[model samples]
Target: MYQLIALDLKAARKEKTTKQKESLAKIALLHQNVQSLGNSINEINQMLMDHDDCKFICITEHWKSQDQIINYGIRNFKLASCFCRKEGKHGGSAVFVSLAVQCLERSDIRSLSVVGSFECAAVKCSLNGMNFIILSIYRTPSGNMHVFLEKMEQILSKISDDSASVFIAGDFNIDFSQDSPNKQLSCSLLNSYNIQQTIFQFTRITSASESCIDNIFTNISPFVSNVINSSISDHTAQKITVMVDMNKPANAVKKRILNNERFLCRLKSVDWQNVFHIPQNDVNEQWNYFSNIFQSIFEQVFPMKTFKVTNRFTDSHHPEKIKNNIKECKDRLDVLYVISNSDNSYKPCYNKEKSTINY
Candidate 1:
């Protein structure tokens, strides 16, 4: 099912003419459960088309059968979905993308074999030769959150190595509240991989007087930009926008290395090995140390001046620098694990054959 849909702004910007800057556009995540009355799909489409800035609209939980989907034929958008015979409705999740941006690869809608659930799929696109992967997730209601997350963790581990920029959004059906950590159940594992979790409460936000459910999480750092509490759906939809800049001078690389060193030094110096074994509770102490390190690296490496490209939005396959950064981050994680006596599960960091250690 299409839990989430994303458009590559960097790709869309290329097609814009000089006079079309005002129409640069915005991406919106409009969450809705169409099964309920008074929230027709046609109304949703009409409301979305009214937005001048809205380019891509990601819809979640369209609880309609296959027959309704084919017969209704909503206009000016491409829809993708995964359905199951639950509650006599063809419901799970679905995504809607504006017809303007071209879909580079076919949609992946199937039962993710790892878990025996008919939920989750991905769509791929190439913007300036950089690949982007957007995945949709829906955990089974009967299954424990841990079991679902474990399966999800295994499935994602295989794809993390891909160079494509990844964005995962959906109806996780799990609450991420710290008050009752048990509510976390199987979904807690996502917190381990730098995935930022934000709640989008549909049930409460629509009718009740509360706000805490539904979510969007991603490992892509700095979170780009987002709009929460938008009123497109009964479920509060969040719109996230990201900008990737790659341009730098040769001297900047050396300076960035120096910056990363300073970041490392700011933390209390400990033998790297001892630091790794810190219990989950104490991981924060270690994270404060390493997060600074990553921020330092990201700050230096992410600026467009780091690479020679003038317009990152137009250049093709220009992520050679970002690829190197991903590699460096992976290496740093490995070194931390080895030094800290932690087992190398190889899930949080991507493992590569050529990623040799340099002691």
Candidate 2:
């Protein structure tokens, strides 16, 4: 669940209301280090309060010290660190999750220190039972720009596998177009990992330069549904709506069936009861037994097909467009066997056999 606000939030600063419910997850990547943050934190907190139901929050290039973070908890959100509290103008990366959601797991809450690199953190969490990985990235000043980008690509590719969904968002420092030094490297990594890239326009910063440095990319799992421009910061925040399935029952069945490693391990672990246990069964026999078990499990879990929008974008204007986009994203997820809902999470609709209407 990633949504970007590509503007300086300081201008429209307002407090959160008691009755407002959060309907989206927000992620902000800012270049303003702690020293220059001004009143942005307050502005951001106010915005978060508005969308109180949105659980997760991630911010890159956070220049604040750990003491400051510990003393004040970013209004209502809990903060996680990925960098040490160094003195005097030193800034790195940090993450924030809402107080309403359960704390699951997080990556090395330490800064990814490279010679020219800024701050970074890799976080792992399950939103409404859907798992996703987020990386806060920063670039350096020295070395072959291409080589630096290549290293970054290597890191992303190494972490992303066929099993989990991955999202990397932060200040890239360099653009992704052909003229940019790391364009090829950026394109190669994104193409290989199937990540989404977006640029937002900010008029307040860079005088009037329309720079597109900040980016958001994803691999597998919840698909990117949209990207929105912001009026909060000098840089445009990306609003990415990730499509996640809500049918938990069917998802459980699919997880057991599709997880080849786990499934094989389970098969090896199963012991025969006192009567008529077959040994070293052929592939077909094993498959038959597996299918029967799966069928029974599915019948118990998913008795009917249900459509629930688990993840979505609040700023998105078109409902039909968003629905269609979500369907497409689900199709991609089905191919990877990563959709969360066991029944509606799979392809061609889970009730094909009992479907009353013809295609």
Candidate 3:
């Protein structure tokens, strides 16, 4: 079975009675190099389910256009901004902010970004008066480092360090696990602004080689960073935990479904022998027989769930107001009917459904 295999956020909150449990940090962001997002939406969706409180999700190498990314939206996250190459073959950047968080896309940054050099999409997020900017960056392996460094300086020189905390995360194609000229130059530029690389462990590990090309750099201090298996990408995913609190959606509805890992295990445990050996030879009957077998299994694995999401700013259907108006109209019609039958003076007041009901 695919277990959660970490300090589940809910478990940490509930078990905070213990002194050690109280030290569990709040996970603020999740970043991964999803080579192709269309192929790994389920894995990312399941990860989001595991960490419902997570604020930001950034991915590199999405290989999607703006229209494609719009069509491939995540469940609880909003598309803050994204960038796709206009000239190159593949490689794109996307940033998805939690719907609960207040965020605005930085189109200015996108305008200055160079695709092969410092390809990135950024968003400015505000929570409880604290503001921070997240840059989902990606650089091609064969791309020129001078262009990357020059673009970085141009963009960084424009933004002041004191305005907001900064988080730069994604694949740079420059390994930080070992020291090199490219890494040193990149570090010098970022460190000038006090933004430091947080993930030093090798993110891409294979039988032949290992490298820390995928990384996260942030100006926020005193953070905890870890590399975990994403189960979808060859490069491991990186997550960061900070002391600050993420904005919890007081109004947004939350609904829980069966865990994906558990569902797979339950499917394997079910007995499908009866489905395979159905005695009926009729095609329709055989279809129904298999359907019933799967139906029972699905019921056992996944129960019903109910949830509602209300937008605080706008509403499409004011059902309560409409219901009250309907009730008042019915009462008026009833009174008119009673009066018309009791006294001829009020005749023809109520004859049909819409007889006297004014719009």
Candidate 4:
């Protein structure tokens, strides 16, 4: 599923003309429901590698605790802000911004409203000279829609007075496909603040139907807005592109990659028996001796070499044959689903094929 999305992004980039590429500085915003980011970290990394311009990624349903937040960090990006459910282990929200972008959590706004049955994380940042307040939220399936909207009204009311552009994207759990009262009220409330939803297509896909529950709303007009067809999760990823000034100077940083094989070999070669041998008279002397030996080994084994970072997207290491196999699995599942609808004998076959896809 992730490989398919990466391939599509690569193909899209290749199809772009030189003129279109050089027109303006564009930042892409991506939102997804990574059932558990810890389990889908590789897929998220592949998506980021494929779309380097993605400056902000809003993730819902992270299913992580406060102490486990560090485990979901993405390379080259900073975890700007996150909100985890206090009572349960299921619902959570997070926003990751590129290291090049200046971003900070908006605790003042977050403090103004209490998240009763929903999770939300917001960040204020400047990207390519444009200031924005981006929010990532996840509303539970059984959460009260009216209560959530009331809190949203307060947040938007406060932010509407500011000049910085506002973007609120998330899985609100309101099915836009049906003419439900909650959907109508949500749309009307957004309209009152002159905020337009950028995502028009359905985000969640299934064998039987689809829905537009995931959305991106912003006050400023974006350069482009579309949904990326992916099976990384039940919901497809929504991407929004906005143009910014390209004349701003860039801040580039260098990072080091340690040689783990050499480090491990050096550690294994250490004579632990001799290192542990110490004078029984003074405990401080024994501690100092061990510390010195450890420091010396670390310095010799793990020397750092700096490499300057660039705006180049790396290709995925996943093989083409494996991607073809995944595609074939999806095709087989679709065929089985269609057949099962008409013939009762195909129901078991559909279930077997579905289990193989691991969607």
Candidate 2 wrongly placed segments (more than 4 Å): 1-38, 50-53, 84-90, 103-111, 140-147, 177-179, 200-205, 220-233, 248-359
Q: For candidate 3, lDDT tens digit of each residue in 9-118? A: 65776676564445443548889999999998888998778767678888899988777888887888898988888775679998999888898887867776787778
In candidate 1, position 129 carries an lDDT of 43
Question: Cα deviation in Å at residue 271, candidate 4?
Answer: 91
Each model's lDDT: 0.45, 0.45, 0.69, 0.69
Expressed as tens digits, the lDDT of each residue in 163-247 for candidate 2 is: 3456666666665532432543355336434565644443124755555566666644454433333445555555455544433
Q: Could you tell me the C-alpha RMSD of candidate 3 in Å?
A: 29.9
What TM-score against the true fold does each predicted structure earn? 0.52, 0.52, 0.61, 0.61
For model 3, the superposed segments whose C-alpha errors exceed 4 Å read: 1-27, 245-359
Residue lDDT tens for model 1, 101-163: 455422322344223243564565444344455555555445354345434554444343344
lDDT of 4 by residue, 220-279 (tens): 665589888656789988988887645533333222233444544554465645533665
Q: Against the true structure, what is every candidate's RMSD?
A: 12.7, 20.0, 29.9, 25.5
Name the lDDT of candidate 2. 0.45
The weakest ten consecutive residues by lDDT in model 2 span 249-258
Alpha-carbon shift of residue 102 in model 2 (angstroms): 3.9
Pull out the clashing pairs in model 3: none
